[model samples]
Target: MKTIASTNSSAFGEPGIFRGQARFGSPMLSDYVWPLLEIRGQRPGPRLCVSAGVHVNEVSSIEAAIRLQKLFDPKAISGSVSIIPLVNQPALYKYSEYICPIDGKNINFTFPGSKGGTFSEVLCDAIMNEWCAGSDCYVDLHGGDLRENVSKFSIYQRTDDAGLEAMGRRMAMCFDAEIVVGLPKDHMQRPGRPPTGFARHGRLALMSEAGANGLLDESSISFHVEGVLNIARALGILDTPMSAFRNARVACNDYLWVETPVDGEFHAEIEPGMRVTKGQRLGAMRNLFGEEIAEITAPETGLVLWRMTHPSLPKGSSVLAVAVEETQVGQA
Candidate 1:
């Protein structure tokens, strides 16, 4: 890792800024610290902020951030690169929860939060005021929550706004994830949206899923590391080739959710990156007595993008897949 001074302030503190957990006091656990590496290049460029561990258990992104920080030399970079690997350190450490242990709030959903709120919300506000709201671009790193493993992919919001789309697409190309999922809608309108979640508006942000939940998978880790490098190069921060870009960019607008018919022991017959047809049986559910409870099928022809790894589920638990069709409403 690149050795730099670790100071205890966000700005006006030091150049090699490593702000330790500043006290937000009791009502909010200020334990979740923000680590930023401000490498001012010889020439100025766009500010890129990469955040990981917002969900805690999705450890790949955190590892990727560490690896990138070490290998990332600001002298070689064109602009600033800020990284907050453990955004939800409370959850990652104490409770070992996917969401924040203090309040069970998802850090991702609690963005642009209030100053005097709960731990997660306050941290969210701090992050917004300290990191995200100021940056030119933000990359929210995530792995599939708990049971779900994800294909190497990034998400971009698809809207009529072309500028946002362009930025997202460029980052997607640099990251070169297996597929690029488009999230057109914001988190608020989302049926089962988490209270503290990502903003689904006109923001220049991208979500990258590296591997499964819980542990660090090497393959996914390597991909994430390389993905960051690729983005750096593509954004003109590093001198390199963009040929590392791999996988097709699948839009989120062209995808659909695969839900379970009834609550039971869910199983998946297909993996995240598999291609399937409309009538294909993606998976099934069974009861405690080994009796088949419900059969899950694809609604349309497309590729299986994500599925639930947690089998013991409740009613309406999203079981298997989001498919991106070859041709959809708008593909040009």
Candidate 2:
């Protein structure tokens, strides 16, 4: 357990207090918003905003945000840092499945959202209009889906945006995550669809993936917390030193997607975070008849970060996993 400083507290309703709100408008309904603002040091620094619990089952992020909030005092930090511990309040109520019942939408996909629409849509619109209006950068935290087994990693948009990429690299370094994914092949595969990405206004964002949803993993929670702290250090919000991996940075073009070739029971031999070699058997697909019909192999050498959890798989369903590849941090 690393220690971080918590400086003076701000008077409620004062100029620089980090405040939380519930109703941005009609459609957007979050049970509560936990907003904390930290101002430290002297010179102006970048404003970094972090959000968690976009998906209710992915509760590790929420824990991470809470831990981070306790570590530092807003009035003592160098720059502005806003922490939103739980983004999907409705879904988080009882560790429910994805999407809020109020409007039933995934907040991540509805970015720069609608003014008058579903609850999630309204929440996105208000967040974008208010807290995220002029953010320097943002971080969207997450974990594996409820029905999947995934490891710790960080996802960022693929591009040659030098400044953004550099910042992303530093943030990833702090996490010391197993894999750092840089592209979205699925989004690219679809002709007109812009990639599965994130941002508040125009800042480059980092989407962190940790353990499987619906289960609490302490290791995952610690990893997420440390990662957020590193980001705070990078942005100069906190006067703490960098984490262990302040030098090593990994770059991956994209993660590999493994799909069910045939309908059968998915007997995955490799769990999340296992390193795999190219041409290796990732897992075997067997039908209810107990007959092994398909052998899933790695398309390229990489780490297995995410895998389907269900025993049965439908033909053509994705049973994908991610791997980190070797690459230099060239000028983007």
Candidate 3:
């Protein structure tokens, strides 16, 4: 249930920020506009490329990207900031879930995009070549989609490049979330699997996720805004005080998704971020007649990070996720 929301069709048409569209050579996308905002600072420094709405119903990230346009002054900023508020414009237009509606492709899996590919591939290719080309910091903002709920966290990768890995960790910690999740770079670089948010850029790439259930929650939006600002300040893009990554209380080695094995209505007893012991009953699945069909329990003793918000669950759907195998990262 979202209390606040943008009353318009697209946030791009909002008054505060409007840079011309970044044209991709896609005839299928000729009818729509791909929103791009560039803010060049008076001073020279590192460039930052931030993208949101890779999953269209992740409204909080999209809203944060839109707000970032007017949050900083061009004169105070160093170098520039490139923001793509809504990457899946068609999906956003139709309120589609994770995949792009036009091509039914997950933008996350397509990186170094192919020019001669489908609409989704072409659009992502443009972004990869245009914004993620150089030594710039790339951030892919994401969160729970229309039916999912997520807590605040940041993700970095364990890439082969130590320098890039260190920078990614620092960037992930800048989000000031209690948890920082790490993924194997080999997994991201390996083909045939979901690439996990274009992290294979082989640079300072990370992800910030907050807000959930397709809501425009102010706190979640601010979480993203402040996190990006922290990174910008740390990278000298802004004049604000630089706050390096220091708030991570736990750094997990992996994040696990819990899939429902049966089709039923879900009843979750625990909210995200709750700490539960192994085998704790997190929830239960019931048929339409209210007969319990399955029991949902914590697979491990760790923090529950996210879950599906909608009650209806189909077998094999990712209904919950947990942060497991963690180590104490920072001071409490």
C-alpha TM-scores of all predictions: 0.83, 0.79, 0.85
Tens digits of lDDT, candidate 2, 4-89: 22345543323354443324434234344434444333446667777787777777777777777667665577666667777777
**Residue-by-residue lDDT tens digits, candidate 1, 205-275:** 66777778667888787777877777777677788775555576665445577777687998788888877
Report clashes for each candidate as comma-separated counts.
6, 8, 0
Residue pairs whose backbone atoms clash in candidate 2: 27-119, 38-74, 39-74, 39-77, 40-76, 40-77, 40-78, 258-320
**Stretches of candidate 3 exceeding 4 Å from the true structure:** 1-18, 26-31, 189-201, 242-249, 328-332
Model 1: how far residue 41 lies from native, Å: 2.3
Q: lDDT at 332 for candidate 1?
A: 33
lDDT (0-100) at residue 85 of candidate 3? 90
**Candidates' C-alpha lDDT:** 0.66, 0.66, 0.74
How displaced is residue 234 in candidate 1, in Å? 2.4
Question: What is the C-alpha local distance difference test score of candidate 2?
Answer: 0.66
Better candidate by TM-score, 2 or 3? 3
Candidate 3 structure, TM-score to reference:
0.85
- Can you give the lDDT of residue 316 in candidate 3? 82
| TM-score winner | 3
